[model samples]
Target: MAEETITLEVTRYRPREDREPRAQAFTVPYRKDWVVLDALNHIKDRVDGTLTYRWSCRMGVCGSCGMMVNGVPKLTCAAFLRDYLPGPIRVEPLAYFPVIRDLVVDIEDFMGKLRRVMPWIIRRTEQPLTAGEYRQTPAQLEAYKQFSMCINCMLCYAACPVYGLSPLFIGPAAIALGYRYNLDSRDEGYHLRQPILAEAVGVWQCTFVGECSAVCPKGVDPAAAIQRSKVAGAKDWFLSILLPRGGRS
Candidate 1:
């Protein structure tokens, strides 16, 4: 018997050429184990060279080749063509982001917002780099260590409705990084930067829809991070009023 063939309907956009983005169809022969990335590569190499997308660490570690496949945000490298139902699979750039070309979306807005959250450890005292590594207990490390799994795939932002409405919302991925570091016992930015995170479009902006977490390929719980931040923010506020000296100083 001959091998089965799959058809892919990919969205294409060229600012200097097309009036707007449009879908292009490509039918290609495929093996059972070939992933979506393989199908895209097949289209690019044999079918059409104009189709554009991003990819690296095709093993799903790089988190670069994320897009909307069949109306869901997922990593192309991890999404298999065999598992998907037969027919023309629709491939488009991630949602809630500006499309730069075919399947590539402008990620600068996402990166810029990530910087606003100061996703790093801010120490009260400048710890000498020469100083030996800051040791952390198993318990302390375990608390926030899970969040370190974030690969910044940007799928969270794509799946986020808040990001669609407010591009400057400093959406899920960066906020997850914030909670990751804030939970570290050695980190001091938690209290100092609390106000910055308390903005209307900041951590409070997260409504815990769980969509971000749902589409995450790395299992990074952006929703959990937002929830924890909310709880921490409230706790800090209550303690500030209860103890005159224990508050943000």
Candidate 2:
């Protein structure tokens, strides 16, 4: 069976050349199961070679190839043309980030925000030379496994309304990653990070529009993490007044 052709309106911007951004259209053929990545490749190869976009791991695991497809952040390789109403699909770089070019936004803002949270596990002691690997129970794995699924795709940031308003919100993805490690029982950094996690910008800024979880490809559920932090912060205040030593050890 032959595939159908569709039109894609891509936004283009060159800070060194153009004063502002402009939208350009390209028509390409596509199969029902074929993702937007196929049409982009066709347009880039047969139509315009200068178009800029990022992609890797054609599968959804890499979290690359994330772009705005008709005002929604999604992985191009996962966006099927058949999913749209009809032709004339609009493609653009993600919102809440500076556009470096067509469909390519500056990720530096996201990287810096993630770094501030220290997304990796911090330990004070090194593993013993003769010690075996760390053992984790099924329940323990279940506790933090969902957060481990984040691919750092920035889709959460794109969907987060807080990020759109305040660039310093710390956003959803990074906070979710931080929560993943903080929940690990083996991590001693949780105590040192308690104040960090309890900050105003940490997770309290999340408004829970829940768009972040809705758009997450890996089902990381950043909205839920933020909500969990909010609950914890609220409970801690009460525990401090009602209990001894502010519920500290």
Candidate 3:
């Protein structure tokens, strides 16, 4: 009997060689256990050495394998071949971002937004080492635990229409991460991050489309985070007016 095979229609682009991106298909032996990343690896290793894409820790933790799998943002490592059986799979770089090569999108914009949010525990002053570690109850840890699961995979950014329309939007993951830090029991940087989150391009730009949460592989609900941030921003604004001397901190 002839071996079963699957077709993968992958995007190809060489900035210096190709004027625009184009699709190139390759046939590979089909295996039920193989993933989309596995197919790409087979093509690169055996069929065509020129095929290029990014993937690491094929277990889906690194978030580097994110791509547009048949028009939806997904981690190729987790996208199984058996799901789309007996035909071609269209794979491309994540949408709403500049493609550096074939399936690699430039993430500098996302990184900059994350940096602006200050996604870290910020203390007013560092306690001396002898003071012992700052502790939190399980409930306190649970407050921001889900938001902390982001691996920077950026699938949220790709699925977000607000980001696609407005490049200046601070975006889902960044805002979610900011909200995470704000919710941390040991953090004292709410005042510092509030201005950024309350800005015109911050959480307000989200529009509550909810796609960011739908495509999250880690089940991180960034849409909820953004909305919560909006609420927090509004409360901060009201407190600033009601108590001029002692607003939210």
TM-score of each: 0.93, 0.93, 0.97
Each model's C-alpha lDDT? Answer: 0.86, 0.85, 0.94
Model 1 stretches astray by more than 4 angstroms: 238-246
* Local accuracy of candidate 1 as per-residue lDDT tens digits, 87-196: 67888999988888999989998788777778788888977989977789999999988788999899999899888887768788888887888888888887655666
Model 3, stretches more than 4 Å misplaced? none
Tell me each candidate's RMSD, in Å, in order. Answer: 1.7, 2.0, 1.1
lDDT of 3 by residue, 1-249 (tens): 999999999999998888999999999999999999999999999999988898989997999999999999999999999999876999999999999898888999999999999999999999999999999999999999999999999999999999999999999999989999999999999889978988999998988989999999999999999999999888877888899675744
For model 2 the local lDDT of residue 78 reads: 94
> Candidate 2 versus the native: TM-score?
0.93
lDDT of 2: 0.85
lDDT of 2 by residue, 55-128 (tens): 98989988879999999999988999999848788998888899998888999988887787787777789688
Inter-residue clash pairs, candidate 2: none
Q: What does candidate 1 score on TM?
A: 0.93
Q: Between candidates 1 and 3, name the one with more favorable lDDT.
A: 3
Which scores better on TM-score, 1 or 3?
3
* Model 2 CA lDDT for position 243: 93
